[model samples]
Target chain A: MQLPSKLIQDAVEEMAKLPGIGKKTALRLVLHLLNSDKEQTTMLSNALVQMRENVKYCKKCHNVSDEEICNICSSNNRDKSTICVVESIKDVLAIENTAHYRGEYHVLGGIISPLEGIGPSDLSIDLLIERVSQHDSEVKEVILALSPTMEGDTTAFYISKKLKSCDIKLSTIARGVPIGGEIEYTDEVTLGRSIMTRTLFS
Target chain B: MQLPSKLIQDAVEEMAKLPGIGKKTALRLVLHLLNSDKEQTTMLSNALVQMRENVKYCKKCHNVSDEEICNICSSNNRDKSTICVVESIKDVLAIENTAHYRGEYHVLGGIISPLEGIGPSDLSIDLLIERVSQHDSEVKEVILALSPTMEGDTTAFYISKKLKSCDIKLSTIARGVPIGGEIEYTDEVTLGRSIMTRTLFS
Candidate 1:
């Protein structure tokens, strides 16, 4: 193989670092960049650099934000009394995109996985609980929007135990074979979560 | 739907600008960056910017370079009288990595693609022709290292016609089913190229 310029190879290597992007895919991206106009490449480069520099976590919700508090947490139109607890900021955005959810979010940074050395103390569970308790009007609901993974379930269970003493309604995102999908391919974690989160369908 | 922060969405949009990457994949990449260590993300960002700013084309061969002439063109060990003609800079690198071809390279920039409105005029054909005529001790060989596509064939034919009067041995890379591949699963293009570039056992 001929050695590519160090700069071009560096760009490909950087792109390949992204999840699911292999070397071939990264090469395609680099080629695209090379073919594109200089103005566009500069825009992409500037955006990448600015993304990390300009964006920050909201202090109140731990969601990605450009301000001290995320827009979701600070907006008066949202249901502040009902905060959904999720494993990461991406989950918050996913739930929000559904448009059916009107409540704010609380990001836990990550789920609990004892095998991976991540525990309750490592996450933002304490902060979530503290937020619920400090609310003046008494929070109504705490919805768990963690993934269907083992760590997500473990974190949910641990959080549930701590919030059990509170009077708030605790629930989780629905679980089942995905919409219009076969059950055979469903992983053990999803199947287990589906069973655990099953509702009484009258 | 809760709107993703402008900064976060902007990053995703920039990622989606890459060829073959859609919005979902871009979002996944952005989330991965969001989860990665600060230093890693910084390095990737810096590398992307550096790639655009630091790289330039080699004046001698029209291959990608960080200096006036590429390493291959400047090296005294290489066969300066032999020029490998390729469709792109990537091809030059691909040939270089084999470490077998000890010669200079000429990047045609792209093959003749009438469907895409690309022609000989769109490529660096003129420069390549000029190089051959101007150089002393007429080049011994010009290896065609283009993809085995219709456009590549047309471009190669055009170049050969232009250099018919010159004293040079013209050759092309081999085409066939890959070493480990079964004929049953061979792609049409490779199979077709193999037929077109067939050689007799005699």
Candidate 2:
């Protein structure tokens, strides 16, 4: 689309660079900012700049944090013996929101996606091995909470192989039909897995 | 959702404030930014700030511009004798994209919507009247190209009443079924209007 103003066009272009936003949606957002109070735009810009400049990754877990270590990694209440391995910081947040898991997290940064040219080296897998193998480490069990995608499974298998000599138990989160999912609508692979891994009734 | 970092939370909150963006989508965008190169985030933030700080509205037509007057208003190629009035800057762009109209535009900024508490004084109506009534004005026609909504009609009627004393002719954009619209699915009001105002075939 041909924009009348260069400033708006620039802003729209920047907004369109986001993953899901397109030129039309970016234009709508830019126009909204232009029409609204100047303070709102200033606040948004400042917040984004501050996030980009001041945010840090947890040295231990690779999760997004304001400091060298994330809050979960530093907290005493969290179970340091069990580290939930996941794809990204978003997965960490999702697990945290459940409020059921008290274990610390290890963000892999991403899964092993060969299609995207992302391999084990592209992720923080080496950091995970180093973290678990550290002398005087309290880690006992490493839970693989990665997604059920093929790449996630590959990453998990790779991590399990690396941790084989570390004297740590390796486990993966259960793969089954979702709690409220209908049997008829469930995909064949998931349904088959759910049937094969049927749990005992209490 | 509970975010690990305050900076991430702040950015997500600001993003969620935009139209159609929810907290989850905001978080997703923020995470994508965090995972990508820092330069991308910096560029987006800088573009937004620059757009907000430097952008200006055309003094003549109220359309967004980088200067005092918009390109269309300043261009000598446009017809100075005809003025097309629209509700917002987007409308001005939409009409310009058609390339059928050669006249300059007068952006009302908004329509008269009592439900939204917007009135005539809140828009640029007075400036439009003043421009049309200028002693040295060459304006001969004012086209009301506003939307066909009730608020648009009210605003157009209000403008027509205001410009009744001027020597310029006043006209409105024809209301009819859209070019590619299916007749069976067309709304009754639009279909009725189209039939009532049907033009003779040459």
Report the Cα interface RMSD of each model, rounded to 1 decimal: 2.3, 1.0
TM-score of each: 0.87, 0.97
Q: List the residue pairs that clash in candidate 2.
A: none
| Pairs clashing within candidate 1 | A1-B97, A1-B98, A2-B93, A2-B94, A2-B96, A2-B97, A96-B2
Q: Give the TM-score of chain B in candidate 1.
A: 0.85
Residue-wise C-alpha lDDT for candidate 1, range A29-57, written one tens digit per residue: 77777777776777776776688777888
Candidate 1's displacement at residue A97, Å, is 3.1
Can you tell me the CAPRI class of model 2? Answer: high
lDDT of each: 0.81, 0.92
Every candidate's CA RMSD? 3.1, 1.3
lDDT of candidate 2 at residue B122, scale 0 to 100: 98
Candidate 1 residue runs with Cα over 4 Å from true position: A1-4, A183-202, B176-178, B181-202
True-structure lDDT of candidate 2:
0.92
What interface RMSD does candidate 1 have?
A: 2.3
